[model samples]
Target: MTQIQNPIIPGMAPDPSIIRVGADYYIATSTFHWTPAVQIFHSTDLANWQLVGYALNHGEVDLRGTNTPAGIWAPHLSYDSRTQKYWLAYSHMQNMAGREFNSDSFAVSADSITGPWSKPIYLTSIGFDPALFHDADGKHYAAILEWETRTGYQAPGHIVIAEVDLKNGGIIGDWHRVTTGFTTRGCAEAPQLYKHNGYYYLLIAAGGTGYAHGVEIGRSQTIFGPYEPNPTGEPIITSSPQHLFSLGDPDAGHFEMFNPQSLMQKAGHGSLVHTQTDEWYVAHLMSRPLAGQKKNPLGRETSLQKMHWTADGWLEMADGSNLAKMHVDGLKDVPVHQATTQFDINDDFNNDTYDPRFMTPYRTQDAAWVNTIENPGHLRIHGHNSFFSQVNPAIMATRATSLDYTVQTKLTFHPDHYSETAGVGLYYDSNNWLYARLCQADTEDHTVLRVLQAKLGERIDHLTDEVTVPNDTAEIRLAYHQGTAQVLYRLTDTATWQALGTTLDVAYLSDEGVNGAPGEIGGFTALFNFIGSVDAHQLTSFADFDYYTVKNNLERGTHL
Candidate 1:
């Protein structure tokens, strides 16, 4: 059987939506507050996956002044056999400050999963976690959670099922409140509906997206019944299975013994798919919390558990337990691709389109900023806005692929005036990042490299704090040994590499580590390495990004 090392899809790939097209499988994940949203991965076997494209093009949506983790939420992808078109349903969680989580579900159609996708059409205001289920006959239904607040409630609101019109906006029929207070942990969400063996099954994510998280299943003879709970009368999949409807509530389960050491905690929020081989697997979001922490890594990534239908017709996990892990021996064998822990940061910029892994902040990146035609060998970015804004800017970055890696890039700057800046750095979030950039000194057109600190809330930049070093062309490298980060720069062809004085404590920059006052510690997403030119005086500057490569396990450290 194919053995997937834990975290088959790692680094901030959360709320995964999976669809198998022929022998190929594609998964799309959420990219909240990170522009160029909805990362898609392709896999011949579930274990080996590579980033392919993004469902949303940059500037497809406007997210100015968006809060951390508030731009885009769960996106559901489904395939229509009748039209042979890939249909996507997703929710943009526009406002979180008011705790609204007011979802505007939208739909987009693409002939191919690697889409030249059509523009999105507003589906409905159906709360969040919008899923599209197309019947064998081409009839489509949208199953979504109607999150509402009530006084003195059993945690939040109910899970409602409605038949939605794909061509039109919402369902033509009335919504049925399937379950009011499921109480499986605390909150119930991420509902996916499937029909198997003369029955309609509804899978839900319950327990507040926390350490108490779990997956609960129910079935009915009709499409939407007063759905009957599982025969066990509890969630079909849950860590600390003995407990139901509550966590740390011993009163919920009386039969099972207590356990104190569980490796996979808060494992739930899932979707089930049958492979081409007719084997069933459930893809759920799980978190790898920081050591000894019950708190999540600012992300809930996708994990899978195998399932089998019993003689009694109840869908149960193969191992009698729900927690997914490193390997499953029963399934068919899957091949492991090259065992590479390093990546190159070089760009040819020859393709008509930039790689999907390269993304800007909120709003569309100007096509003019990156020129394959105008500048054949280099990238010219006419920086219209600064990096501080969530809108238009020439900022592009990739996920921190690993914790231990060396990232270096050669940059040649053609600076015209002061106030413009360009450079690369280790970016966790907008507020919490550190790196060095080449800026044109206000007094002279000569470009001087300056190291900048992006700490949250302290608006006053300590530019004068670091001695400005002169460099018209320099090769900059960020070497991260475990938690310590050192910035080094060398003049072109120079054997001597000058260490930009001072080291940064990077352990605090991770989502599982330290969160800036305004920044939240996110999941195990990558610290991006990027190169850009910020224009100071409408001077069109070109940055010849020679190459960028990331290698993991370059060295281990003691700090973190």
Candidate 2:
């Protein structure tokens, strides 16, 4: 027997949709505001996974000026055996003003999972989290959450299903309104339909997306019908299995539902896949808060839970407990790839191309702003807007996968004006970040390094202490541990690293600390360690980065 650790895909990999084609398995996760969206991971033994590629890499969708936690949501990945094609269904959340939750759903297909993806075909504007299901009779059905804005209705709305046409992006006829949720835990969304043993099972995420999050199921004999809820009247899987009656509740962050016994919180939004040996598993999203706090800095991650179908056709955890575990049993016959290596960021800028794992927010990465071929041995990033702008910002970032990690970068930037700055730090979004950059002082011939922070839309500058750089170039490093960060810099590689600023508490950069809509949850994204440039003076200023490296301090056996 092999034991698989939780969080198969960690650090900002949420809303996982898993499918197994023959012996190979693939999982697609939501990217939110980060581009090169729709991350797809490949796995062979269910214990080890690798990020293969993304489905929406060529500007298939526009995410300009997108708000926090409101870009691409819950991307569902499925395959049709008849056409031998892969399908992806996702929602582009355009606006959430006045609780309208205006969004448009779209679908894209490819012959292979990696490349030549087709243009997005518009599916519906009725709701979000759209998923496509191919029936045995060759009929295609679409399921989505019809958002409700009225005062007295079932808060977030019901899961609606209808026949859809893939070639022409339109629904067949009317959409049947199914149950709002299987249990009293309301705020139902992310509907994934499956057929097993002559029954159509509809799995949905409920209890908002917070501490009370859970995976609920219901079944019906027909495609559209009054489905019967699971007889247990509880979620099939959740972090907190204690029963709670929260029907029609619009709040997403049920902080009171946090369970003390489990390190993994906010476990829900699952997608199921059957292994080749007839075993079952569910890939779900979960979060791990700080030691004794309710803030989640790493954001929602992907975890696997072993499942079994009962004689009554109801799905449940293999251990006969609804509470999620930190370790689960692996596949029966397949040997576990137990000792996997973690990916560390070590870009030397000597190659002609940048790392494929690097992603930018609020804009796409193109040769217009980011160029590697222009500078042979250096990554010349032309600064665009300021870090506060929800527009185009020159930032090359990677997910912060470890709780304690160090990020180092060498910058050769000569800023003539104070508005042109270049440096590296941790970033959450446009409104919340901590930056340490090199900028020009009041005089023209002097350069200085300062630390700046943005928390809940308020700017705080550490003007008390500033380090002067002699030649306008230096090596910058940020060390983060638990929930605090320290900025350090040195002019040369041989010199010792000197602290530039006092230790700052950056726990506010977590998902529960950032600002969002007036009545909704705070943020859905995690903290990212980034090397960026800000040239508000003129877009012509560019920063030459020699190398970028991220060193995780966790032991190999624990984190991997």
Candidate 3:
């Protein structure tokens, strides 16, 4: 029998909303502030998954000036077999300041999964993480977390359900308040409704998306429920199965629940699907922190666990344990054609178009700034704003999938001014990043390679090992191990790669290390390797990237 690895979809693909249409399985995840929002992955066998396309490729919504962890939230994917149309519901988190948590939810539909989706219909602004449930009798309902800001109420809020009309955005009746949580782990959100055995089951993510995160379930006879908790009154799946003292705490970092023996952490926010063979599985979000460190640089990834319905009509893990596992048994003898055990990326810039895996922050990328046709065998990016700018920056990046990995790129750039620089490095967001770029030296006339660091929005320059490049081309590489990074560069293909600066401790570029406002959680976005250009003087300066590659030392596993 084939064994499936955990994290079916890795690197910042959190809050998985999975469903099956016919014989194919599809999962949609949150993109946060990245453009082409709502990443969708398809799989035949549960072990292997591939990125098919993004649902919001066109300018469906503007993400300009979106803060860290504040754009696209959980996206629910559902197919109405009767109508033969696919529906998607997602939340656009616009603000987090003052704990306002103001968010707008919308719904869009298309005839096909990979599609020209219709314009978004406004759903509600009451909360985030909206999910659409299609009933067997042609009734549609929306379930979401109604964010509560009152002093005495629960910190996050309650899961509410209401009937909604899909054709026109209209709520049928008042929002029905369901149970806050099915267990003591009380930061309940991401409510997904499923009907099985004549019961409407409500699956929710609890434990605040931190060290104690887990998936809890409740069921009721009616759609709007005074739901009953699971018989065990505990999460069905979690990384830390032991009891946690901080049950109702709203803190995002629960250091007490950090299990030293476990490789996976923060396993919660699950969605379930029934296979054609009558086998059941749940896809949930999980995180793998760096070895011995609690900081998660890869953010939350999607993982799968085999589950079964109890004789008493309750959902339980097939293994009879609450703890999530690193390896799971495949569903029967499902044959998969293209399946790999590891994750790596290599792009040669040989095609006229860019890969869908490469993404930009905030605004949609314009062809004038980032294009491949300008340079036949290269990716030409015209520098516009600096990396700190939220408006427009010539940056093309892909998610960093592992802690021990090397990201290398060959760049050809001519920087007439000191502010005009272009190269490759790792980026967390606008306020946190590390870049080794080809820029002009203050004392010299030619271009030189320099290393710059941004920690908590403060810029630091490592000016010790600056190397001057006589030509326009250079190869730069960034190797990250554990929580540290080393930047290296060479002028020519045959030249030895020289270290640009001392090893820098980049553990702070994580979800917990990056400081957030008083009422907001720190960045939950994943680390990215990008080749970007900065032109403070003018937008005419451009950089051509010959190739980019990412190589991970470890196999795709549950730990760093």
Candidate 4:
């Protein structure tokens, strides 16, 4: 079993939808505010997964001013064997100003999971986490909860199912209301359907998506039920294992009873997948609080737990407990694969094109702004004023996926003009970043290395020491040590570094800080290691970056 750290997928990888196509398993996750959203993953053993592509890549949605936690919500991935088509279903959570739960659900189809998918066609303006269940009778059914405030009856939020026309993408029959779910598992939602042992099993995420989250099971002999709750009358799996139902918190399906001893908190909203070896697994979302409290830095993450079927015909955790962890062997001894996250940082810079792993800031990339032919084998980044106020400027950034990692790169320069600064740094939002660059003063054309820091909506203030770049070939290393970070610049040709200072409180500059804004957190956002050249005042001199690399000497506890 591969000893996966609790979250198989981290950093806001919430509402994961997994599907099995023969021996192949794939996962599609939600991305809120980021462009080219809906990341899809593929795996052969179910334990080792790799990102294959994204469902939305053509700027189909607008995400400006999206509040924290409100861009794209739950997304569902499913495949049809008859038509050999892969489908992506998701909700665009447009407005959250009133917490009104306004969402638009849609679907897109592709011959392969990673491909030229058909354009998204609107399905319904309903609640989130919409799933399409293919019935054995050669038909498809759509399941979702209709958030009702004016039903005027006892049940406001109800789970409804209807026959769906997959070809035209529309509801084809009268909607049927299944049970609102057992009283103990209140606020029942994120319904996923499966068929086994002559029963249509409806699995749902119950309780709120908060402290009292759980997975509940209900089965029916028919696609549309008369569904019966698991005989246990308790959640099949949950973090804070509870049977408590108040029926008072209007959001919790109006139930008041709950269990007390749950280990994994907020363990709900999951999808099921059966491995090639006939083992069953559940991929769900969970969060880790800050030390003792519930201030989460990395938002809802994806976790996997083993599950099995009971003799009584209901599905449950393999060990009969609701905790997220399982004792079964997952992929404990899988060999380490080559680095899939990035490229070799050491570069001669004479290459005609940039590496694919490198990306630009908020704007689309322009190829004409850079040229290596001017000076053979040297990167000539013509500074277009400071890092700001330019769309197609020279800035190269890479994703920071691990908690602790070291980044190193070499810089060689012959700047005869003033105000040219080039170096590496960590960036979160547009308003927050820190860098260590070598600059030349306009008056004497004197070159010096300087460190700078920027806070929320503030200028990049020069923080510390200024010294000469010992030699022309300066090697720089930045170590992001957990919550803190440090920068060390050395001249490889001279073999000595004039040390600046380390910023220990990196959390303050993260999405958990004052600037990391909404509909934007971990999913659609990331901290990047960047290599840039800026002309403090005007574009005069050029800063040449020889190569860049983030090290394997991670400072985290696990030494990743």
Q: Candidate 4 on 154-267: residue-level lDDT in tens?
A: 333677788888778778867788967765656777788888889988888777655566778888988889889888887776666545763423343111222233223467
Poorest lDDT segment (10 consecutive residues) of candidate 4: 253-262
- The models' CA-based lDDT, in order, is 0.66, 0.89, 0.86, 0.65
User: How many clashing residue pairs appear in each of the predictions shown?
Assistant: 12, 0, 0, 30
- Model 4: how far is 430 from its true place, Å? 5.0
Better of 2 and 3 by lDDT: 2
Candidate 2 lDDT by residue in tens digits, 439-528:
887676788989988888898988876989998899999998878999999998799999986899999889888884443458879989
Residue 75, candidate 1: Cα error in Å is: 1.0
lDDT by residue (tens digit), candidate 3, 6-78 = 7777788999989898889999999988988999898888877888889998998788888777999999998
**Per-residue lDDT for 137 in model 3?**
94
What number of backbone clashes does candidate 4 have, counting pairs of residues 3 or more apart or in separate chains?
A: 30
TM-score of each: 0.85, 0.97, 0.97, 0.75
Which scores greater on lDDT, model 1 or model 3? 3
Candidate 1 regions with alpha-carbon error over 4 angstroms: 180-183, 231-266, 289-298, 330-334, 341-353, 414-418, 440-446, 460-469, 481-483, 494-498, 512-527, 535-542, 554-560
Which segments of model 2 are wrong by more than 4 Å?
A: 339-341, 516-520, 556-560
User: Whose lDDT is greatest here?
Assistant: 2
Comparison by lDDT, 2 against 4, better one: 2
Give candidate 4 regions above 4 Å deviation.
1-6, 62-68, 145-158, 173-188, 207-211, 231-235, 242-266, 288-296, 326-328, 331-399, 408-476, 491-499, 508-548, 552-556
Worst lDDT run of 10 residues, candidate 2, spans: 551-560
